[model samples]
Target: MAVIGAAVDSETKQVFDAIARSRSVTTSRLAGALITDFIRAEKGGQVVTTKAPGLPAMGHAAAHAGAKTEQVYVRLEPYYYDELGRLAAQRRWYRSAYLANLLYAHVDRLPVLCHDEVNAVRQVARQLADIGRNVNQIARKVNIDPDRADLSAFDFELVRMLLDVETAAVKDLVHANLRTWGATDVQ
Candidate 1:
């Protein structure tokens, strides 16, 4: 390989360095464009801004190798960290691999909920929990002594109606929240 030295401003150097690192564009092409721009400007003409040439076709492995990845740091509680370690061990994977998989599983294809949507969801969840508790209490009463309690079919119907109303309210609120947040297509 032949090397050529040229003086350029720091900003220009940064642009050239970025192009070279991309691996899709050559520094020689970038240098040619810069020189063209300089010639036009020297002639008292407007600076010509042209798009970079297309990249050469690359093999699958070359493309994969050229792709960039970044490292991310996260702080976790000790208990959570230990649990993650245990899960990784159970799966016979590195901690990073297990954690990445867990995150993808939980978040993949999920809609981005805003603060208001999240709060609405939490409220609906609390209401559902309350309804569940009430149903459980009714069940316990019936199961403990069915003969003593005069719980007729009407009582069960009333409970069912209450559940239906709560379920409908929760569904409507969630739908409205998602709509307001501009997430209409989410499942």
Candidate 2:
């Protein structure tokens, strides 16, 4: 290896020896590599930060064999919003957790809402269904003549009255429940 360390001082040799010991490589091979690097820099003006010791033909794998690398991206939203909502819900804790999933969803997994809010929404829906059922039931009870050419003579105010009653009932129920539970009026 052209008398390795022909140009480097004893301190450089000690550094190379330490590097070899720490890296679990032979001193002679590391010294030979340093000499070859100097020769390459002197002759070809090529400066490389890393020097590789000689490898056998069968051991041609990379120094960092079996290493893996990847790239990823992250997205962020407000962190405190959900936590505040959850704490409010826990503070009240009057409504069931399942109803919260029904706020903006039919079955589940559509959107987020506190349990109190979802129960209020569900109560409104139930009141509407009740009004429809009551209208159908009253119509059946009155025995209106369907054979008539025009049943416009019948009182239409009854239907409006039923809807108003339903609306009032839902309002009273929601306001009372919200007061009872002390749910935060976030949504």
The CA lDDT of each predicted structure is 0.60, 0.52
- lDDT, residue 50, candidate 2: 45
Tens digit of lDDT per residue, candidate 1, span 1-187? 5555799999998866765545455677656666777898999977643433333222211233465555668789999989878867764667776655444333222233445546777877787788789878878987999887565643767767877887787677656544433445545
Worst 10 residues of 2 by lDDT: 55-64
Off by over 4 Å in 1: 1-111, 181-187
Scanning candidate 1 in windows of ten residues, the lowest lDDT window is 54-63
* Candidate 2 displacement at residue 52 in angstroms: 61
In Å, residue 91's CA in model 2 sits off its true spot by 7.1
TM-score of each: 0.34, 0.26
Instruction: Enumerate residue pairs that collide in model 2.
Output: none
Judged by TM-score, which candidate is best? Answer: 1
- Residues 135-157, candidate 2: write the lDDT tens digits: 68657755766564354765668
